[model samples]
Target: MSTAAEVSQNNNVGPVMRQGELAQAVVEAAEIDNPDKIIKVEDKVAYLRIQTSDEMILKRQTIEEMLGRPFSMSEIEIELASFAGRIDTQVEYIRFYHAKHL
Candidate 1:
């Protein structure tokens, strides 16, 4: 399989993850990519996303953690299908999705 760098080839080496999933992954990446990120855990679910200017960064594993399972083929398709129409650049998009489960 292609490595993270090969996938995010245009970027500075990273996995090929979705914008929404990337938002969640970067937040879950580690404590260092933080201070700007703040997760809001409500009910039985946890919402996460990044607070940086670059929304294209993908760190796939974070999404799996949030999802609790590898996303299904249809699930991935659905998220990407609606990806562009979502215009909220400033707010936490991934968290918005996560919050729904709460």
Candidate 2:
């Protein structure tokens, strides 16, 4: 079995959000903001699992554009059911990635 550290080293990361409009907007935003990476979404009835290789970033601007209104990064916590890898959040963007060993 792979340990957490071993798994994290693979660099797969993303957000698992509750099934709703907010989750939908996140999916669209992730796709737009990370065009260089292949984004994958899995539906689990209750939530949506959105993932990407190496790293994934969701910009507030892109989400706001998808939502057609103002958005706050703090609001994402309400819909975030879980996540993979480490997360770095800012007022303008949220990033999911594995911390590289130096």
Candidate 1: worst-modelled 10 consecutive residues by lDDT: 93-102
Assess candidate 2 and give its TM-score to the true structure. Answer: 0.87
**Candidate 1 Cα errors over 4 Å, as ranges:** 1-52, 72-75, 82-102
Give per-model TM-scores.
Answer: 0.27, 0.87
lDDT per prediction? 0.33, 0.90
Q: Candidate 1, residues 15-98: lDDT per residue as tens digits?
A: 222455433444455323233544321221232222232233222344456656764323433433222112222212231121
Candidate 2, poorest ten consecutive residues by summed lDDT: 3-12
Misplaced by over 4 Å in model 2 are 1-9
Best by TM-score: 2
